[model samples]
Target: MRPHRCWRPAAGGWLGRRLLRPPGALPEPFFLGLCLRCGQCAQACPRSAIRIARWEHGLSTGTPYIAARETACDLCGGQAPACAAVCPTQALHLEPGEPVRMGTAVIDATRCLAHMGDICRSCFNACPLRGRAIVLEGALRPVVDPALCTGCGLCEEHCLVEPAAIHVEPLNP
Candidate 1:
């Protein structure tokens, strides 16, 4: 039998697996085994950020995940995360007030307008958590605060640059 290949960003491989999982997702191994693939999570998402894993995902097929660049999780406004609330299996268990660390945003300095000495604050302004999750450094350069970031990907979705100057790197843990 072939061994499973978990996605790793540094390797620049597994491009398709770079998708971000919904908030409160279990670790990948457990999530793959426990998720019922009922697509309830996808249906519950107001932003339509969560999607069922496709056939190309191999063993992970039918699980819910997010592609932040396309659509980002909005945490469902004032309510609990909708996707997790609708999950039949406990695969997406999230306690109330629990923080989600979906992934971290990394800015590519070469492509970032603010980092290049431009005055772009799109990323900073678009962040739902604003000053807490993303802060402006020198020259209004947006810097992600990993400790507070929920990896909701709103910043990535709002980035004006082609190919996006800042992107979320999925956290497998």
Candidate 2:
């Protein structure tokens, strides 16, 4: 599991950041309306990816979200996502062809050892989308392909560097 570390947005954290939602989740408002805050998704997650929001999140308290840097959604292998399967309100959906669209990852090359002339493939190896989402460049540096990125945050979680060289930017809420 990835260790705890807070992500601070450019404008500061709580005021500017949005919570990362689970895969196939309805837009923020819609999901919130239908979600029963029952914690079923959290219980069903095999990877323990979903966490219920606490009081600090205001109206979102008890809502389900994926704190990707801490734990990322695995989409329950190739099967229907476990969280969505157990959600009685269907706040989360299942689309046959789309695997997921949690968010996209952006690499800070200054911190990336590979980009700094060291051989590293941590992000590439950790990406759930693998070859499609993260590719190795000529210098063996990992490059992200946004079109294929599922934003699972496995790359960020597996990063060997403290503060992680690569981090997942959450979807706009």
Candidate 3:
């Protein structure tokens, strides 16, 4: 006999005006919501792309923040996000092969720790599309190569510091 696939609860999930909500007890979207925020999506992630946002973003407190650090649906291939599969939330709106507009990654050299005098290259290393997407503007700073950039937000996500020097913005909407 097959065992029952019981679901668990995720702590400190974030809610937004744009996001869809379901019902009671299970936070906002009941029935459909069943995530434990255990970070399975991050682990299964081939790119190590998923990220959970902190309190600093304001809009997203404990919720999963994908846009800021690593945008672009590289894993989806014009389909759905793998991370959502782990999410109990029908909250993540898991769809098959749905075309998604991923956010774009950007770098603010002036504010970047690398540019500010820190010998940090976290952003450069974090970018999956390295060499093509992001490149060294100088010994101290990095620049985003628009020509080679798929606009993946990895650089923004793994900045290794607060007020992320790299910022990922939504595509032209």
Candidate 4:
């Protein structure tokens, strides 16, 4: 069956992966339809993890997005996500204690220190789900379990590599 208009993947992702949205954001078209661009979500973020989309984002301009390399969502220390809490519309929604599956972190093994025979577990150590979302193999390489990953970007943020061996992909968008 043909995908519904609102349910189809956003065009941005057709060119490249979608930008990381704030935790609990609705699907792209639904979010764009409902979001008021009020900036409330960005303001509610304790870590200032949310940013207004720039003009370059085209249709997504003024929407709340997260740059994991700069800062990652902390889910307000496991409470309801602040961005979702402050959303006046259904653009975002997070129930208390719900894990934020914002995106999935993928590791570039070619660039990862551990995969190079060095010992680096920064991504594993920074994962909110600890051993569940990210794990270490016998060779000391960090592996991501997509099913369990919250995609909160902590691993990307904490990566010690210059370009970051791990990066979050907006899988849900």
Candidate 5:
């Protein structure tokens, strides 16, 4: 007989607003199915960006995720993304040369320093993809390009505001 699967709660409630999956992770359904829930991806993360969900997160418990506001994905710098590389089940599969899509960064102009008439280019300057993923508009306002952004959360990580002016909206969230 097959062993019983330990099912956690789904990504709902508070988790839905905060969960950010590791770079190159498969879509929600596919990832949940293929992931071994063995904590390998979290262990392989060099920046310690990946974390397993807790029991409070329900069905997503033990699932790997990221909280970009706290720490962001660095793309592993000069190597294949570690989380994907270590996922034995390919739940975090990454196609060669394809850009990862963690989510899209949304700017809250009401809270952004630049949009509020200050000279803050922190978000644009911090972007790994720079001019491509995030660009400077007139008056140094930062704009996120959905087509080019991987939603790696560098912008959110670098934002100086008490609450980040720019934050990623996870695909499943």
Candidate 6:
């Protein structure tokens, strides 16, 4: 008897374990255990901020999720959110404030096309959270509600064109 190259079992335990994995590149917990590795988050993103976690986090590799290096959560509105809507799993949970229960969305008015008066609202429209999270300030400026904004970087990832109008930053305790 012999085993075929294509037909082989996993090298290690498939269940119960801490699974010491690699450090997440994305500022947010995009690679949280709850993630199903589906690229929907990336595909739906207008700004293309969402990307797959290509590196090996413990034993899993190619799992669909964003790495800290590639992007982070914008924490949309603090109420409604975009990524959460697309995410099949509750992996990308909800929270309030700049920490976004997970992360925070920061406004880089200088880089933001909306602030530049170029006309872009990918973030505004895509945001699942609202009211306190992200506020539509003036014509194009979007004010982040620190008390209600989660750091879920969705806004940053959905900005039209190049440099995202908004960016995600780890919530400062």
Residue pairs clashing, model 4: none
Per-residue accuracy of model 4 over 1-173 as CA lDDT, tens digit each: 87444432345422444789888988888888999999999999999999888755667878898889989988688788878888999699877667678888999999999999998889989888988899898849899999999888989999999899999988655
Q: All candidates' lDDT scores?
A: 0.82, 0.80, 0.52, 0.84, 0.83, 0.51
lDDT of 1 at 60: 69
Which regions of candidate 3 are displaced past 4 Å? 1-101
Error of 4 at 54 (Å): 0.9
- Ordered list by TM-score, greatest first: 5, 4, 1, 2, 3, 6
lDDT of 6 by residue, 63-132 (tens): 4433333454433323344565576665554443323354456778888777887766677776666545
lDDT of 5 by residue, 1-173 (tens): 64224432455324245468888878887877888899999999999988888766666778898888898988897478988988899988888987788899999999999989899999998899998889888748999889888888889999999799999988754
Model 4's C-alpha root-mean-square deviation from the true structure amounts to: 5.2
The TM-score of predicted model 5 comes to 0.89
The top-ranked prediction according to TM-score is 5
Q: Model 5: runs farther than 4 Å from truth?
A: 1-9, 13-15
lDDT of candidate 2 over 79-108, digit per residue (tens) = 778888888988988767767887888899
lDDT for 99 in candidate 2 is 70
Best by lDDT: 4
Candidate 4 global TM-score: 0.89
Better of 1 and 6 by TM-score: 1
| TM-scores vs. true structure, each candidate | 0.88, 0.87, 0.47, 0.89, 0.89, 0.45
Q: For model 4, what is the alpha-carbon lDDT of residue 168?
A: 92
